[model samples]
Target: MELLFLGTGAGMPTKERNVTSIALTMYEERGSFWMFDCGEGTQHQVLKSPLRLSKLEKLFVTHLHGDHIFGLPGLLSSRSNQGGTASLTLYGPPGIKEYIRTSMQLSQSRMNYELNIIEIQEGIVFEDEQVSVSARMLDHRIDSYGYRIEEKPKLGTLLTEKLNGLGIRPGPLFGMLKRGMDVTLEDGTRIIAADVVGPPVPGRTIVILGDTRPSEGSAALAKRADVLVHEATFAQELSDLAKEYYHSTTKEAAQTAVEAEVKALILTHISGRYAQDGAQLLEEEARSLFPNAYVAHDFWSYEIPVKSREEI
Candidate 1:
């Protein structure tokens, strides 16, 4: 999975950054993309990336702020215009449905595909064979939420040598065995999948938070995360201002990551006042607390590296 930052600036668009939108592309895993937030001009930003609106399957909005969701209507309308017919589901806090519905109605926008809007609560919101998503309320100006996306543990790799030793050549039976199914051979010998298979491969966890102050819920949601995407809207010196605005500072975000024991921390939703140099300073400040902390810029993409069993 890869994270594509379409817009990373906080509150408003700047020359260096747009707003807050991120695309979690899972083309290899699911052949689809999931978007988080859709700030203004997000469609224009997508045009500059390799992501396709047609391949977008899910959207998770953090809050109803203008900078976080103003581009929903335009992006939805453009998706239909571009002949996107796949079903899309949106998950967000309460009032998200009303906002999307009202915007589409006011603009006379008609979607060609099914659009599902879910008003989420603080718990598990979505689960499938591959992934499970949970939401937790965050300390923001509004009812913002942080999302914990946990990939399901994958089946252990097939022990080809073990199977070969048992006179079972590669075939459809091997596929079933890899899925943890027992098989009976022609010689009347029963093969137990668990006995031959390796340990289950641990899944990766990612926590993406909305605009918020550092809170216990944030750390809980980010516990053992492979990547913790937190908002850092202010530097260390302006931490008081950050708390006053219900946003996090670089130090606060780093501390959250450290407390959560996340492997990496990516700071987004940067304030527009921070230019390239200022953004670098924010990264440096965060790195002082957490060595793996980074400040994300618009259009920057990050690949979450998988961990081996030993590392986990």
Candidate 2:
């Protein structure tokens, strides 16, 4: 899995960054990508990245903020025009259904594909065989939410050498062993999967939060996540302003990462007041508290590699 920042700026767009949108690309696993938020001009950002609009499978909106949902209608409309025929599911707050329906109705937009919108509440918002996504209410101006995306554990690698040593050449027996099944060979040899297979490789966990102040919900959602995407709308000096605006400061964001014991912290939703150099300062401030903190810029991408058997 990989994360690509479509826009990282807060509230409004700047020359260096746009508003808040994030893309979690799982091309290898699902042959598609999922978006976290769709800020204004987000479709433009996607055009510049390696992402394909046709491969967009789901969109999870954190709140009803304009910066978070302004690009929703545009992106959805364009997806229909861009060879995106597959059904798309959107998860958002209570007002999202009305907002999208009204926008489409007023614009007279016609889609060639199925559009599924779910007005979400706290708990597991989405779940399938491969992964599960849960949400919790966060402390923001509105009823904002933070999402926890956990990938199900994967089966371990097949012990080809061990199988070969047991006179089990590559065949249906190998396939059965890989599927964690015990099989009796043609020679009446009973082979146990656990004796030869390695331990199960642990899956990765990612936590993405919308605009919010430091709260237990954020920490709980982010607990031991491989990556925590938190908004740092202000620097340490403007912490009071951050609180007043129902946003988080660099220090506050970093502290949450530390408290949650996340492996990495990615700070986004930067205010435009921070010019190129100022944004670097925000990253530095976050790193002071959490060593693995990084500031995401527009089009920036990070890989969350799968855990190996040794790591597990």
Candidate 3:
């Protein structure tokens, strides 16, 4: 899986960055991509990237802030116009349904595909055989949430030597065994999948948080994540301003990464006041507290590698 930052700026758009929109592209894993937030001009950003509206299967909105969701209507409308006939699932906090519904109604927009909106609560928001997502309320000005996405453990490799010894060659039976299913030979010999398979490969975990001040909720949701994406709207020197605005500073974002013991920390939602040099300062400040901290810019992408069993 990979995270593509479409707009990393906080509140408003700037020459360097747009607002807060992220795309989690899983083309190899699921043949689809999931979006996080959809700030103004987000479709324009997508036009610049390799992502396609037809592959947008899911969208998880953090909050109802203008900077976080203003481009939803336009993006949704464009998806239908661009031949996206597949159903789209959206998960977000309460009032999201009303906002999208009203926007579509006011604009007289009609979508050819089904739009499923789920107003989320503080718990498991989505789950399937491949992945599970849980949400927790963060300390934002509004009811913001942080999501923990955990990919399910993958099946281990099938021991070919062991199977070969049992008079089994690579075929449909091997596929079944690789999937952790027991298979019986034509001669009635039973083969146990676990005995001939390696240990399960550990999955990866990612935590993505919305705009918020430093809080336990952020740390809790980010526990031991492969990567933690947190908002750092200001530098350490602007701690007072960050608190007043209910946003996080570089130091606070780094502290959460440390507290959660995440492998890497990516700071986003940067304020426009921070120019190129100023933004570098924020990264330096975060690295002081957490060496793996990185300040994400617009269109920057991060790859989250799947962990091996030994890594776990």
Candidate 4:
């Protein structure tokens, strides 16, 4: 799995950054892509990348703010035009259904593919065989939510050496052992899967916070997260302004990462007030509190490498 940031600015689009959108690339896990916060002109941003709206299986909207969801109608309509024939599911707050339904009705846009709109609540927003998603309320002007995505664990690797020692060659027998089945050879010797496989590899956890102030909810949402995407709309010098706006400061965002013990933190939703040099200064401030804090920019992507149990 990997995270591809389509837009990473706050409130409005800047020449240096767009609004707020991130694509969770699940090409390997789900054979599709999932997105969070389709900010304004998000479709335009996707057009510049390899990700396709047709392959966009799931969308998780953090809030109903314009910068977070103004691009829904455009993206959904363009998906059909892009020759996408697959069904799509969108998860968001209560107003998401009304917004999409009304917008589509007003625009007289009909889709060729199935469109499933889910009014998101605090519990399990999405769950399938491969991945599960949950959300929590955040401190914002409206009913904002923070999302937590957890991928399911994969089965352990088959030990070819162990199998070869038992006179079993790699073939359909390896497949059977990997599927947790016992196999009996022509010589009446039985081989159990446990004896020929290594330990199961753990999956990845990704946490994304919408606009919000400091809260335990952010910490809980980030527990053991491999990558945490948090909003840092203001630098430490603007702590009072950040609190007034119900947004987190650089220090507050970093502390949440430290408290949650996340492996890394990507600070997004930056204020345009921070120019190129300010980006470096803001990154430095966040990292001083938490070494893993990283300032996010538009179109930045990172992959989660698969590692063995010992490597982790």
Candidate 1, residue 276: how far the Cα is off, in Å: 2.2
Backbone clashes for every candidate come to 0, 0, 0, 0
TM-score of each: 0.98, 0.98, 0.98, 0.97
Range of the 10 consecutive residues with the lowest summed lDDT in candidate 1: 303-312
- Residue 160 CA displacement from its true place in model 2, Å: 0.9
The RMSD of every model to the true structure, in order and in angstroms, is 0.9, 1.0, 1.0, 1.1
Write the candidate numbers in order of decreasing lDDT. Answer: 3, 2, 1, 4
Model 2 ranges off by over 4 Å: none
- Per-residue lDDT of candidate 4, residues 1-312 (tens digit): 889999999999999999999999988777899999998899999999999888999889999999999988999999999988999999999989999999999999989999999998888888887778999998998999999998877889999988998899979999999989999999999899999988888778899999999887788899988889999999999999999999999999999998899889999999999978888899999999998778988888988766558734
Q: For residues 1-312, could you state the per-residue lDDT of candidate 3 as single tens digits?
A: 999999999999999999999999989889999999999999999999999999999999999999999999999999998789999999999999999999999999999999999999999999999999999999988999999999999889888998888889999998998888898888988889999999988889989999999988998999999999999999989899999999999999999899889999999999999987988899999999999999999889999988978985
What does candidate 4 score in Cα RMSD to the true structure? 1.1
* lDDT, candidate 2, 153-221, per-residue tens: 888888889888887788888888888999987788889999878788888999999999999899999
Among the numbered candidates, top lDDT falls to 3
For candidate 3, give the lDDT. Answer: 0.94
Q: Where is model 3 more than 4 Å wrong at Cα?
A: none
For 1-312, candidate 1 gives per-residue lDDT tens digits of 999999999999999999999999999889999999999999999999998999999999999999999999999999988778999999999999999999999888899999999999999999999999999999998999999999988788888898888888988998888888998988889999997788888888889999999887898899989999999999989988998999999999999999889999999999988997999899999999999988999889999877676764
